[model samples]
Target: MTDYKLTEYSHKAGCGCKIAPADLEKILSQRSGTSFKELLVGNNSNDDAAVWDLGTGMSVINTVDFFMPIVNDAYDFGRIASANAISDIYAMGGKPIFANALLGWPMETLPLELAGKVMDGARKICEDAGIPIAGGHSIDSKEPLFGLTVTGLVRTENLKRNNTPEIGDVLILTKQLGTGILGTAIKRKAAKEEHAKAAIDSMCKLNSVGAALSQITEVHALTDVTGFGLLGHLMELCSNQVSAEIVWSQVPSFPFLDEYLALNIMPDNTTRNWNSHELKVDGLIDLKAFQVLNDPQTSGGLLISVAPSKVNEVMALLNADGLNHAAIIGAILPKQSKTVLIK
Candidate 1:
């Protein structure tokens, strides 16, 4: 409630603060861990969460995500960050059981009361998701940061993987894009209030439908679109087994995106996202297109891969669940020289 803007205290906003995907790959490539048989999902794949089978037809899902302020309001930032972290569990088709807060604050500049408001906001979202912030760790830092380490559970048979979609599966995005550009606009004090609020609303909405989606027999693969942008995550979903055909116009985006794009408003990470996977893409003709494709998102949406025969059925489910922006943007196909081609 003070005049201090949280964005001014940090260099990057939201998921834009994430490391570039290509370099993250380089770092992960050198990682070594026990190859336990019960580990159904691990860092070996670019999955939303690590799933460990519990030997009772169920599995436990584990993940942690955090970021600096993407909005000026401390309360909204906490809600968005917590929603982003808990989304990994939903993306994996799990119902969150509990969460532990992770916080980093600058006591030298920001007040302790502001940090308390953040905790209050996060607790609200966790409660809305039917969970609690049971515990956490905190530290005094140079800048402010917050998120959650969420734990969830799912039937082993219903676990979703990003790389296991069928070649003919239809690709569905459950939320509109443009959070990065809008958030950047807010940071620069160029965004209209309505546009900034729209982005925050998108980020704060929980991807809880992911749990219900897993129950559908036709749903094949799932992953949330976050920092890496749509194309980066599509690359992971495509892997080497298949390629993707994205219909550019059909891709859902915030209606105000073009208004901001005219001013060249965009997150700094947009180019970083493009450079990471440009070699594997085609049919991208200009900077405008690249900006939309590679814009980093914080607590964005679910990218659901489903059997083509179930497209209508899935759309109905999404609409009923309040994801009206959800649309069939593309389809998975046999592997191509380029992993993703858009038109």
Candidate 2:
């Protein structure tokens, strides 16, 4: 077996490599397009996945996501990437039926055996999700990358959106934050074993709970926090109808995140994330808090907005599903010039 560190081969870890929000928007803005009435959800909304109405009371959800390794283990990297890709479907309140593997390899650098292990790891996750890898395409590339293009089905009425939060809605986050910070620590060999394990465990978790939450009409808006971080994703929920007020102390985060932050260990994407939308943030009370909020997350968690009356029910469902760290982090308020207000 070849002993290789996957993270060493990649310039950026996981979603940390995503194009900065500002740059992406600029690229997307240049394209003028004809609208399709059947396209329920598309780029205009910055939604997790594109939904096409099937016109039979069901909709087809499609999304593709791929990224470079964030961990040293080939198997773990595969699992995380697969989970991250499939999360978009769950975020749209759909059940994934099948997926097509997406792989890129540095043929001269990494051994094929390690790549096979990556596929095996992704296969295990597909099995757990009760889906099959129907087909895929591969390419020779500079770095080893893996993910999936998932297809899902959802009742039209059950489809959740990232831009539908209403005033008085409560925000519930399904997992703790700080994966980006921990990932940076891992690359620098500065993280404790327990902290690394925590990050990997969180990334490996599926966000299928978002689909389940769709059954409750009170779930006004749903999105999985990924490369953009919690605040970035929350801003999507706020849209134009309302703004968010987050109680900084109530947000769920890794136990030793402060230790990593204190050492100045942070992802490169953190600054890009803040700069993209900092103009719309209010009450920037703590610098560390601001950085943590902007830290890119890989396969992080679901950020849900639910009607205030259903907060208890939503929390109960999350806890019953074993999301113990899930928390009611904030609430929606009347639209303000600022997108988010942190206390």
lDDT per model vs. reference: 0.93, 0.91
C-alpha RMSD in Å of predicted model 1 compared with the true structure: 0.9
Tens digit of per-residue lDDT, candidate 1, span 175-250? 9988999889988999999988888989999999999999987899999999999999999999857999999989
Which pairs of residues clash in candidate 1, taking residues 3 or more apart in a chain or in different chains? none
Model 1: residues with Cα > 4 Å off, grouped in runs: none
Superposed Cα deviation of residue 149, candidate 2 (Å): 0.3
Every model's Cα RMSD, please? 0.9, 1.0
Superposed Cα deviation of residue 155, candidate 2 (Å): 0.2
lDDT of 2 by residue, 35-94 (tens): 999999887779999999999999999999999998989999989999999999999999
TM-score of 2: 0.98
lDDT of 2 at 235: 78
Instruction: State which candidate has the highest lDDT.
Output: 1
